[model samples]
Each structure stands twice: as C-alpha cells, then as structure tokens.
Target: MSIITNIEDLRQRSKKILPRMLFDYVDGGSYDEQTLRRNETDFDALQLRQRVMVDTSGKRLGRSVLGQSYALPVGIAPTGMAGLYYPEGEVVALAAAEKWNIPYTLSTLSICSLEQLRGSTDYPFWFQLYIMKDRAFTESLIERAAAAHCSALVLTVDLPISGQRHRDIKNGLSVPLRFTGGGLFDMMLRHGWWRRQMFAKSKSFGNLAGMASAENSKLMGLAQWCASQYDPSLSWDDVAWIRKLWKGKLIAKGVLNAEDARHAIDHGCDAVIVSNHGGRQLDGARSTISSLRSVATAVNRQAPVLLDGGIRSGQDIIRALALGADLCMVGRPYLYALSAAGPAGLDTLFTILKNELEVCMALMGIRDLSEVDETCLENPRYFSREY
Candidate 1:
C-alpha cells in the first residue's frame, strides 16, 4: 500500500500476505538456523572502501556467466514451490528475469512445468536438477530439460536428503499445503492472497504432475513421496553420469568448500556455485560469502564461481564480487518482492538493486564489475578467518 523501496519492505509485505506455512517455508532454515543468520550478518561485517575524488563515468553492470550475457551480474536462483508465494510465481519471476535480460533457473520442484515456462518466453532459462532415488526418473528429468532447450543444468549437490527444518515441521508445510484450522484461519485473514491463489493457474507441482499418481498428489502423500525420492546414496559418480547425459553447460550448485569445488570441476562442471542451499541444509555450515574467498582460491579460476545466500541488495552483490565471486544469485529477496506486488514488485526490486550497485561502485571509484576486487574491501582479517 505504501512506498515499497527495499527488500526488507517486500519481506514484511510478504509476511502479511502469505499464509504462515508458506511464508515460513521460504523464510526459515534448518535446525538452529545459525548458518542462515550468519549468511546475512557476515555480509554486514565486510565494509567497503569509499573513494571520492575520482571519475565515476560510464558505469557498466553487464556481465557474462557460463557464456551467456546478462544485464546484471545476478541471476534468479531456483526456488521450489514458488507458486505458493503467489499464483504462478515461477512464471511471474521468469517474466521479470526476461524483461531484465537475466537468467531464471527453474527448480525441479517448481510449480510450473519446464514446458510451460519454455512456452511462456522465447528466452532460454536454466534448469536445476535434484537427483532422486529413482535413477530413471532423474535421467528422465535431464532428458526433459534438454527437450525444453535449457541452456544450462544446475546440479544441486547438497540436498541428498532434506534438512530438518523445524519451522516446516511445526507448521506442517507441504507442496499442496497441509491445512490445519489455524492454517485455514491464517489464509482467511489474508483474503487477497487467498482469492488470487485459489483461482491460480496451477496448484500441483507442475513438473511432477505426470510422475505422481493421483493418490500421491495429495498434501501429505506428496510430502511422503518427495521424502522417499531423495537418494542419500547420491555421489560424484551421479554427477559424472549427468555430465555424460547433458551436453549443455553444467553448473554444480551447493559447493561450500574447496574439496567440493574441486570435485565439481573434476566432474566436468563449467561453474561452481558456492552455496549452502540458502542455509536450508547444514545449519552449522559457513555462510556462502564467508566461504567464497576460500573456494575461489581453491578453484584457482579453473571455473567461474557463483554465489547465492543472504544476497539482499546490490551492495551484497558487490561484496561477493570483491570476495572473488564471478556472479551472484538471489533466491528469497526476489520471492519476497514477487509475493509483495507480483511482477511489478520484481521490477522495482531489480531497479533498487541496480541503482544501489551503481551508487556503491561510484563511491568506491569503480565504474565496472571488472574493477571490483579485494582492493575495494576494508577488513582483510575477515576474509582470512576460517569459518
């Protein structure tokens, strides 16, 4: 209703509009949420070096990641059940990314099917794959991504098994949403969200629709099916198998340490995303930004290193770039913006991030992304500290 100028504003608005379960699913992390809290706090710990008496003309934010050009050095990270944020949320976010000329990754668990998203726009979007217990199903998903003309395959390596998210358990969160009386009451209170989402285009998990039988499509049943599908036996061998199957650029997401980063490269990945699944898994693990410097050093520029987790603003993106990240991905911030005001909120969010990045660059006496490096940072000790 009032002026929504920042990501935090969008977050608050999303809290007000979304049901508690859906909101918690996006907002909360695993166990004690230590990693989740650290992700943002560590960014605050890093201060930028400001320079005044220099030319700040002809600033450029455009960047190329894994052979694709982007208007910004950021991409929309894959988020599951984005439709729960708003009706057809994935499609809306993809549309926004298309308008901005940035990549939008479709999650394997996304509500919109790959075909649906591909049909929505001519631009090629990346596809994120989760290796399930069923190898046949996993291979099928890879084949489907190729059929959909996905330019890249983001293999999420961290989630061999889902983390124990306390909020999700307490709220009884599920794909279709297990509605309790309290949950129903919460939804009733958010009348606008209810009206919009109830009549929304798709309610079931779009990608998994044909795979799941009608009985397994129910709220609790779908949760059970999903739980049973996650293969704890998933390993580097699977990544190798996927690489052999997929001809496009392969990005290994969820690389938090040097060993994993090296393994990602060894398995023929084009890029390694230094992430902890937004702290949704491994709650005690180090934040993505805190691990970026070390991972980047280990990789030694063998492959481009991308980062995701607690990136709320353009200044955060700059911090990641300074720490050795080639590109940054955002998840919750854009979801909150989309939930707050649909596609328009995403447009505003992008505008705010780009403006902030430009302003920060100018203050640092830097005009382009290439000019950003460790020199723009203030505390060297922070980067050296082991997480």
Candidate 2:
C-alpha cells in the first residue's frame, strides 16, 4: 500500500476498504448536498496573510476550552455507528484523543455504552446527549455519564427529526443491518473489512441494547428507534432543566441562528456550537461558517462559540478560528481515518494535520491560535452591506 500523505488520501483509502453503504453513510450528506459542498468551499475563499522573516522557533498548539487544557483546540464530534467504521472504532478514537490530551465526545447514539468506555481510558472525556421523548431514558443516560465521570455534557438540539439522506434510504442503511441476498454478496465482496469486524466481537448498539432486551423491544431498526425517541418538542426550558441535572459544563450544539445563541447563553449554556449538523440536517441551511460571525456577535463573547461542519483539514480549523470560533470539531475526517487505518490510521491523520497546522500558522506569522482573527479575512465587496 502507498503511504497516506493527507486526509484526502485517507478518505480515498476508506472508500476502497468500507462497503458502499457504510462509506456513504459516513461521507454523504442530505438531499442535494449543496450545504455539504459549501461547507468546505467557503473555507477556501478565505485568505491568510503571509509574514516573512518572523521568528520561527517556540510556538505552542496547546489551548484550553471550558476551563480544561487541550493539546489543540480540535475535538472529535460524536458519530453514531462508529463501530461499523471499524470494530470498536469509538474505543480507538477516544483512546487516540486521550493520548493526544484532547477531548473525545461520545455520541448519545453511539454503539458503545457509557460503561464500555468508563474504564477504557484514564481521561474523563466529555459526553453528548440528545434529548429524547423518553424523559426517563434521557435522565438515566445523564446519570450514567455522571457515574462514568464525564466532565461535560453537550446537549445536541438540532436533530429533533433525522434528516433525509437519500443515499441512506437507497442503500438500506439501518441498524442490525438487513443483509438481503444482494447485501450478503456485497458483504462477501469486502471480505477483509467484514472479517475484522465480524470476528473481533459481537456487534450491538451497546448503549441502547443495555437499557432493554433489544430482541424483544418494539423498535426494530436504528431509524425507527431514533425516530420514536428524539424529542421534537424540546424547548429552552428543557435546557435549564438539564443544566440543573448535569452540574458541569453545558454546551448547546446545532445553533446556527443568532437568537438561539443568545437564548443558549440565557439558559446558562457555557458554549454554543455554530453547526448545521454537519449538513446532515437541513440541507439548505446556511453554512456554519457563514452564520458564525452573527452568532459570535450575538453571544458577545459571553459564551464560547465553537463550530463544526465541512471541516476537512487543519487549514479548515485555522479558518474557523480566524472567523471567531473558539474551537472546531471534526466529524467525518476522523471517521474516515478510523475506518481506513484503525488506530494507526487515526494517528497518521492527526500527525499530518498537526504538522500542516503548525506550518500554516508559522507562514501566516502567527505564534499561536490566539493571534488568528478577522484581520486575516477579506470582506467581499458585494457582501459588505448589511442584509
């Protein structure tokens, strides 16, 4: 195999190794995918000022978020079905984050249970919770996180209803994958991936299946189970309620509008992520980068504003920082790494990004991430006027 040089290469490799259904699940976006394409393109439009003859030595990537130190400002966004990417990919991903001294957030919908990761690593990683119609189940999950010693609770408010990804529907992407005769043939074609995944251990949605006997439960598939549980009527009052329950740093994910940012702060949220659910929900929603400036301004620095969507590289992370995000979360890139190369692959991807980020910062004449701001961006002549 050729050496993996960058994230793009890893993505290509992942595509080759993973089955079509699973690869599309990780890489594809909602219907039309316009927002998905824009997420990456918008970052390219921004230009960084290059400084020559600047002192090159002694730069640090270390930073803090929510009163905790991170090796860098990047965190892994929670992705469901990570195990399908690789056998026990969540464990490998979190373990990688622990080694790097950054936070790894476990998705509420992840296949791994809180118990599975509780003693898996020494670091107390953060936990993400999606408010469900089952209030008892949601509360119990929060209790589980607390019991597992999670340091923060990230409440994802965007996906009240799952977005319609046409690819997923066409590919029959569901939990406990229904392999029709054709599907079995497809699985047989990707024998290497199937062998590693199937032989390592039994696969189940560890977190959900733990709550009840999945075999006897009414929810037959992942889509059905997720649809029945997500609380569509969630309100700010619920945020306040969760605030009292968590007693730790609270981050509200999926905020793209300024009004929501202000309300998140009012409800005592410590941070508001400027995200469009990675373009997975609301296909036509404004790019998280486009909406970020207003969202950041509305919050008025009262709360840390982070972003996640369309970030594919270290340069993208820098672009978000320049635009006023306190930090950035990467979803699909790491998933690709985990799927393509396992723990070793993730390590390679992180190494390439860290090197590239440092070089970009040095060339831009910035000593640290704190030095990045609006000065590096050009306001388009057509967009200078207020909307």
Candidate 3:
C-alpha cells in the first residue's frame, strides 16, 4: 500500500477505506454486471504491437480534442455524489485535473456545486447534464453552467429509467440514504470519511439540493424532488432544445452505437462519447471499447469520438486511440484514488497513469498520440461490429 504500483493498487486501497455501500456504488454495475466485467476484460483481447528500433525520444502524450490540447489523452468522467468518496471530493478532483491539465467533468448530482469548483479554481471544466422533468430546473442548471464558464456540456442521453443496481438495493443506499443497522455499522466504520464530511461544505447533492431548497423544498424534500425528476420523457427533441439554448462544445456522453453517434453529431453535438454508462445502465450491452471500433468508423473524424469505461491503464488508452477514440474519460480510477487518499491520491493516480502511458509509448516507438493508429495492434479486429 505504501508504494502503489497501479490503478488496481489504488482500487484495493479504496475498497478498504470506503464503506461497503459506497464502494459497491462505485464498483457495481446494473443487473448481472456482464457488461461491467466486459469493460475491463475486453481490453485483454487486444494486444499492443511493440516495436523497439525506432526513435521515441520526441514522444508527447498531448492530444488535441475540439481545439483544446490535453496534458494527456484522458479526462475525468462525471460521477454523481463524488464527494461521498472523499471530503469536498469534486473540488479535490477538479483541482487535480486542473493541475494535470485534463478536464474534470462535474456531474449534475455532484456533491460540490459548479460555483464551488469555479471558486476553487478559475479553470474551465466540463458539466454533464441529465434533462429533468422540470424544464425550468434543467434550464437553470444550464444557466449555472454557462455562468461558471464551463468549457463543454456533456449530455448523458442514457438512463431515462434508473437501472436496478442490486448491490445498492441490498445495501439500502437509497435516494434518502436509508440504512439498516448493519449498513450503519459499515458506514460508521469509515469514521474519517464521515468526520471530514461534517466539516465539508455540502453533504447532499450540491448541484441539486440548492436548486429546490432556494425555492420551496428543504434538503430531504429536495432530494426526493430531484430523485423523482429524472425525465423519462427525455427525448431527441430535448437534445435540439438544449443545443439551441447552449452555445458551447456539446458532447453526447452515453452513445453506444454508430447511429446514435451520428444522431448526436447531427443534433449539434460537438463530439460523441462511446459509453455504456460504465455498464451501469444496460447489463448485456457491448463494452464502450468494444463499441468504439464501429462508432469511430461511422464518425470517421467528423468530430471527436471519446471512449468511457474499461480504461484501466495507459495501455488501454492506447488501445482506445488506435481503435479511433480521440481521447478517453475515466470515472472509477480517479474515484478509487480519491477515496483511498484524498487529494494526494489524485496526484499519485495521474502520475502512475502518465508514467504507464509514457513507457507504453516508448516501447511502441510512438513519438506522440497522433502517431498512434490501428496498425499499432497485433490483431486490430479484436473489437467487433456485430453489436
């Protein structure tokens, strides 16, 4: 634990530090979790073609997406209730992303608000949104993001209905956090986390609770209100509506098919993120990396194609790029690190991934991310079009 070697090490540490319900929330996916397993396991099927003789001395990890250059071909994907993992978690993660020069996406349900993050650092971050039942509330959220000077708006088009995560039900990690005696014991065991939470700015959904409380509902009532407001009526029409309202880089963050990717681009999305909601939505759906191949082919460079899920290492990022992803977004990796060691863990996580990427690039004789392609893999057709 002292000398963490990789993301898995961070994962192990996080599992110990985080309470059972919290850890399962971050770790488990929907239904049987078949897609969840595939997200990580699918990477093993693709092998990187290592070349030794060429000069890799001028290597750079930098990759440009939608006119902005990233420190690496990675960004932190939006995760709800991120602050539950650590004290002021979203703020810490955003600051870390700023330091690393990669974008940190603020979730609609994040514990820290956009203003908090903007105040913490002036750097522009991405905001992920889910169209709510209340159009006014959703618009207000959009207005807030614009006020915060968010660089991009990631519209997550999946989850019209919440997936049944068995672990959460079993653990009683409900909307208002109903806890059984055992669940209370489990949470209480992580004393440091809750102790720090007492001093933290907001313990509930930062972006959401304030939205309602300022109007009529109190905290718990607001949580209930927000919970019931996830729009099952969210549709393609809503996409166009949001597109007209906001004039920033719009990224569709939950696309899993070529047609969906094309539709997002056609609907004014600046880019399409090939994701399966980290297998948190549909259980039997294809892994994001597995689907990236065909989606990238369909996109054909019209706009950036980003991959989310199944990326555990720098090598996985390489695989994603070679398959056609412009960049990658990580959720669980950073979450694990943050839960394990707070702010320093974020630095360590980025450091480990950067070094791993650098070493992988060096071994592959790749000068930069632009030099990466399908040819870098031994058998490039590991990703299927069958989906």
Tens digits of lDDT, candidate 1, 1-387: 349777898899999989898889899999999999999999999999999988989999999888888999999999999887788988899999999999899998898899889988888899999988878888989999999999999999998898999999988877777687898788889987888988888887888876656435563555567677888898999999999999999999999888889989998999999999999999899999989998999899888999999998889999999999998999999888888889888998898899899999999999889888898999745868543
Q: Over 4 Å off in model 1, which ranges? A: 214-219, 385-387
**Best candidate (score: lDDT):** 1
Q: Ten-residue segment with the worst summed lDDT in candidate 1? A: 214-223
Clashing pairs in 3: none
lDDT of 2 by residue, 32-56 (tens): 9988888888777776677878886
Q: After best superposition, candidate 2 residue 281: deviation in angstroms?
A: 0.8
The candidate, 1 or 3, that scores higher on lDDT is 1
Off by over 4 Å in 3: 175-178, 210-223
Clashes of 3: 0
Across 13-52, the per-residue lDDT of candidate 3 in tens digits comes to 9988887988999999999999999999999899999999
Is candidate 2 or 3 superior in TM-score?
Answer: 3
TM-score of every candidate: 0.97, 0.95, 0.96
Q: Give the CA lDDT, 0 to 100, for residue 247 in model 3.
A: 93
Supply the TM-score for candidate 3. 0.96
